[model samples]
Target: MVVTNIAFIPARGGSKRLPRKNILPFLGKPIIGHTVLAALQTQLFDRVVVSTEDTEIAAVVSQWDVEVDQRSHALAGDSVSVVEVCLDFLDRTYKNRLPDTMVVLYATAPLRRAEDIQSVMNLLDEDCHFAMAVSVCHWPVHQVLKNHGDHVVPVFPELIHSKRSQWDRYYLDNGSTYAVHVDAFQREKTFYGHRLKIHEMPRARSIDIDTVEDFEWARYQAERMLL
Candidate 1:
């Protein structure tokens, strides 16, 4: 049987750190525009939808000729979770007809490539319920320090003097892409499931823009990549 895949991007209007972050221009178009275009380029999704409450964002998405899943004000707040937004979109748009796979792409992840999106989606198969894009930690985990009341202390005191090879490597979610089985996502209400896979991405492509500094860094990285 053939399986249908849908790409969902959630970009709410209100951003405290950076105003209109979703529509902030990266290279030539808005940041979300990059994600939408990347999703379209993948050719893996049957439909690419941007879920947002901002009319300006909707207008940007319209320029790409993709469907815009208008989010309700209730689910489009600062405290709202991305999972909630995905569920709302699924309910409103595909009540009767649910896709086999759902790819959740963050609008702020401008450095995300189409190949990375396809890689994560490909990991979501019969046994796997979710597949997320993650990047290996740049710094040594043993050297990480935590702030105490009076002074800073190593997070792992036992590994403070240990070699980097002695410590287990850590990986962090890059927030670039999340691929989940639609039915499994609806049942769990989360991307984390029993059979979840991780698609390791390089640090250069793991930039998730939240603040102005992050945006600037992402811009630099994006421009450098193009050159």
Candidate 2:
């Protein structure tokens, strides 16, 4: 049937805590232009790349005409892992043709929609190979704590002081959507790999913008849920 969805957006630049954060400015677009316009309004991507080593985020994601894989300053570091810039854009643009779905969108999680990435590609059926977009970990994930220099501890140390309403209804990975199955991502290249499925957004669209108070609380929830 020749289906091939490929919306990989990993805008890397020198962001040491939000400098040039994927072309900043949010509510009037620029934050990877609303994640490349929610992967082109989820007309279920045939291709909507953006792997940037930054030529002004590859000229603002080539003005949404998409394709801009110019990465490799040794995969543009800061310990490069958007799964190694998504296997370096599937080993440089689908080498020898391999794309039967691989969406990873995360331009700092711009208020995920476009039916929250087509409902995580409608759970990518056929015994699943991965799909994502979780939320509802509204703090107190089993009293998580760390830093052990005369201070905190319980990072799930037996869920210390456990408030188990079944571990407080947890769910996370709201790193704004993902989907897999490029043959189980070339055999488990990992996005929590095989057989996974989920799609439960709504921590007001799961904000993932790093600091500056999470870009002013995702611009106050994108001005009350992006118009």
The candidate that wins on lDDT is 1
Note the Cα lDDT for every prediction shown.
0.88, 0.81
lDDT of 2 by residue, 73-125 (tens): 88787887888778866776655768888889888887887898888888988
lDDT of 1 at 21: 96
Badly placed stretches (over 4 Å) of model 2 are: 1-5, 8-22, 25-58, 63-99, 109-126, 133-169, 180-207, 210-212, 216-227
Residue 162 error, candidate 1, Å:
3.1
Cα deviation at 165, candidate 1, in Å, is 1.5
TM-score of 2: 0.32
Off by over 4 Å in 1: 1-3, 142-161
